[model samples]
Target: MTDASLAARAVALDLVREVLRKSVPLDDAFDAHPDLGALEPRDRGFVRLLVSTVLRRLGQIDALIEGSLAKPGLPKAVVHDVLRLGTAQLVFLGTPAHAAVDTSVELAAARGAAPYKGLINAVLRRLSREGAELAKAQDAGRLNAPDWLWLAWRQAYGTARARGIVEAHLTEAPLDVTVKENPAAWAAPLEATPLPTGTLRRPAGGAITELPGFAEGAWWVQDLAASLPAKLMGDVRGKRVYDLCAAPGGKTAQLCAMGADVVAVDRSARRLERVKENLARLHLTAELLAADVATWDAGAPADAILLDAPCTATGAIRRHPDVQRLKQPDDVAKLARAQGRLLAHAVDLLKPGGTLVYCTCSIQPEEGEAQIDRLITRDDRVERVPVTPDELDGLAELINERGEVRSLPGMLADRGGIDGFFVARLRRLP
Candidate 1:
């Protein structure tokens, strides 16, 4: 194998180990791994695919490994990661068996698992032969996702839909982007399909930076469901909009694109820098503040407020597969409390006649519907604005009975599913 290929594999292996054993999110690992960016573009792509594929199907890969091994337990080291990636290639990636086995053995030895090199070789070879049939015997989502999350989904979505959610998580997400203006005009030029919601959808894979209009910043990567909350604001031309917890700035960009003077607030200075970079690229401007959204005073009441509060991010597992393993039930409960606080605080930031759009990129009702319900119940000023069918491009199914939007990964499956999101539009009392 080429040196670049070997280096990429080693980095991918480290990322898998970091997520599985150390509980680090894959996105954070990618940001932290210096070698990943230094590699050739092709190798870098391979590393990402290898790491994500392994994470997406880790449960089935481990089950296949356990079946192959004569022993019961797998070590949390180089040997284990090597075997996992090897299995991923053999079964999921459709790599030639010999290539998978040889590279894995090489990687195992290089990673200081020299003692387990023979073990890695034997295990991978066996998996290459029998892994597919064995994988069929496993419940990939049930095995891969943490039990706490699995139960939460079952309780929240019911059995059939919960199963569908897990099944969707196994597949990688499509590339969906929001544009500054004229989605159709840019869609054909960019080789993208414009969705009913005005977001452009493209097949997943390829470096987003390499895509046309990226450097020019005509469009930015934002999930179809994620872009909806800003649309719920109706017309915000010249309106003051406060986007709480707006890091990475997808919705903030949307609000800015719609001619809103947006104030984006978040606690992390580092993440807010990303917002600045995106705005600069898109030639859109927003007021950015590095302060706690729950406590930071906006200096003036907003005409509209978009509170995209933090949650467990279970709905985004298709894109961030590592979330399935890293997020715990306690994480959900803790975030729900924060969501409640943020929702309450956001209400205070809105003018009496303004819109308060509460949304999360999470599917959890506790973070979405339940939080809003509580806010409207206790506060006389808050009431559901009820998203009309016309606002969502006639996709009335996405709007819940309570007039909230709950999008799952399973939605729009034929055209490649969108990310799961929950959005509720509320109005402040006059």
Candidate 2:
């Protein structure tokens, strides 16, 4: 095996270990990994694909690996991970059989587990030969997702829709970007298609930094669903808008670009600094505050407020497969409680007659509809401003009966699935 291939596989192995074993988020692990920066960009992408394939289809990979092994279980955690990486390549990623097996064996040896190299080789070779047929018989969607998540999906949406969400998560999401102005102007140059939601969609390939408008800061990478909560604010020109829990600020940029005086608040100073940098690059400005949204005083009420509250982020499964493994059932409740606090605080930050858009990148009801439901029932300070289909670029399908925006990954399967989001627009009582 080539040194580069082994190096890439080694990095993928470590990343998978960090995500599955230690429960670190994949993007965070990839960013923090020192060795990753040393690899060529192609190798870096390869490593990401390997790691993602493993996580996104982890259950099936494990099943195939376990079934291929001569013995019932592997001895160590790292060996399970080693086998996982090899199996992902073989069964899911469609990596060449010889390259997948040889590099994986080398990767195991590189990890000082030379004794298991033979076992890995034998298992992967067997998988390379028979894994596809084995995988076909398996319920891949159910295997890839956690039980709690699947149950939650089933409870919230029905079994069919839950299965749809799982199936969508199995595929990688395409790249979606929000542009500063004139999407039509940039679409051709970037080889992108304009979506109904006013964002540009591109294939998930190439260095994004090398894109036509990226260096010029004409657009920024954002999921179409993520960009929606900010859009729900409805003509923020000269409006005072507060973006609560804003970090790595895409919404802040959107608000600023729409002529709002934006105050972006987050608990993390480090994350706010990154947001400041992104806004600077985009030629936009916002009042950046490093303070807790639950308590930080905005001094004066806002004309519009957006509370993109934190949650399990289970909705982003397609983009960040690690969320499936990293998050726990308890995490949803914890974050839901926090989201409740932020939602209440954000509502208070809005003036009478002002609009408050509450949203989460989570499909969990407690975080989205339940929070809004409780707020309207108990607070009496705000009333739901049911989203008309027209507001969503006429994508009426995304608007729920309650007028909230609920974009499911399964809803747009033909055009490539969109991220799951729960958005509710409300108007504070006078």
Candidate 3:
């Protein structure tokens, strides 16, 4: 391996360590790097791939490294990160066995851990040799998830279902885009398929803006599952729609594209600016408001409201691996509480007999089913409007027993997979 490649790997490893040990987010670390600006494009991509892949399989990687070591007495943080990067290369990335082993040792040496360099070298080489055997022996369930999280998932969704969800996240997610007007005309050159709700599914690649339809503002990238709740609100043409917690506004854009008068509200000015930019590119207009939805008032009730409430976002682990690393078990409950509060506020903003589409990109039942259950029990005016099989035409695999739309990554295996999302549509009685 070249000196520059090893150096970049080291920098990325350091960043991953800070994220794992100190809870710093990956993007923040990337922005703070003093020398990251000097890296070539390929090297930068390598850095991102290494860090993100390691984060995605952190539990398994740590378990493998722990099993390989005789004493397991190394500093928790150091060994945790070293093995994470090394295992990601050897096991997940298909990097040459020698390159994965040697580069990691070189990284250890550069970090002033020359004493343990031999240990790092020997263990990784052994891993490269017996990784498959080691993995087979490891408990697939415990190896892939933190104990509490695994247990929570098991309880929420049976063991088999939880295991399947974790396995699904291991694969790369397809890039999905939302097209304005005709999907066939816009998606043909891109060689993509138009899924339900006019989302274009394509293999992930290149800068989004550099994609064929991007320059023309023909479409904007949005996951197939993430685009559904807004669509479930039915035709919004000429209707007053309130999009709470809206920013980077894919849903808000969807509302405006359907000819709705939308008040897009979000807490962050920076995020709201992104919504404004997206609306401009799509040649759509919506009222953009920067304020916390939990506190902000829409001034008057709307005909329809889309509350894409925030949760732990466990569903998007494939797209944003950092979520798996940064979010803790307790965070789920905290986020559920926030979602409940936001749902209550959003419901209050809906006019009687109006539709309220409550949704979250969360696999945990607490954040989706349980939250909705709470609402149904307490809010007498709200009634469940179960999504029908036809409404999920191309997405039958995502519809659950209770009619909530749950898009698991494994669902659209043939057409191209999607993110895990739970969407429930409801209506307030007059």
The most accurate candidate by lDDT is 2
- Candidate 2 structure quality by residue, lDDT tens digits, 1-430: 7888898888898898888778888888999998999899999999999898888998898888878877798887878888888888888888999998888888788788899888888898899999989999999999988999999999999999999999999889999999999888989998998989889998997899999989889999999899999888989999889998898799999999999999999999999989998998899999999998999888899999988887888888999999998988889889988887888888888899999998889998888899998888889888999998788875789999999999888887777769999999999989
> What's the true lDDT of residue 84 in model 2?
88
C-alpha positional error of residue 150 in candidate 2 after TM-score superposition, expressed in Å:
0.7
Candidate 1 residue lDDT tens string, 1-430: 7677678888998898889889999989988997877898888888889999998898888788888888888674677788889999999999889888888888878877788888888899888888888887788867887677778888988988788788889889989999898888888877998888899998899888988899998999988889999999989999999999999799999999999999999999999999999999999999999999899887899999998898888889999988887887788789999999999999899999999998888887888889987998889998898988998995787888888899887777887887889999999999
Model 3 CA deviation exceeding 4 Å by range: 136-142
Ranking by TM-score: 2, 1, 3
Looking at model 2, report the run of 10 residues with the lowest lDDT sum: 408-417
On lDDT, who's better, 1 or 3?
Answer: 1
Misplaced by over 4 Å in model 1 are none
Task: Assess each prediction's global lDDT (C-alpha) against the native.
Answer: 0.88, 0.89, 0.83
- Model 2 error, position 416 (Å): 1.5
User: Tens digits of per-residue lDDT for model 3 on 67-164?
Assistant: 88888656645655776788888877888988888888878777777677788887788889888677777665456566776787778778777787
User: How many angstroms is residue 256 displaced in model 3 relative to the true structure, after the best TM-score fit?
Assistant: 1.4
TM-score for predicted model 2 compared with the true structure: 0.98
Candidate 3 RMSD computed on C-alpha atoms after optimal superposition onto the true structure: 2.2
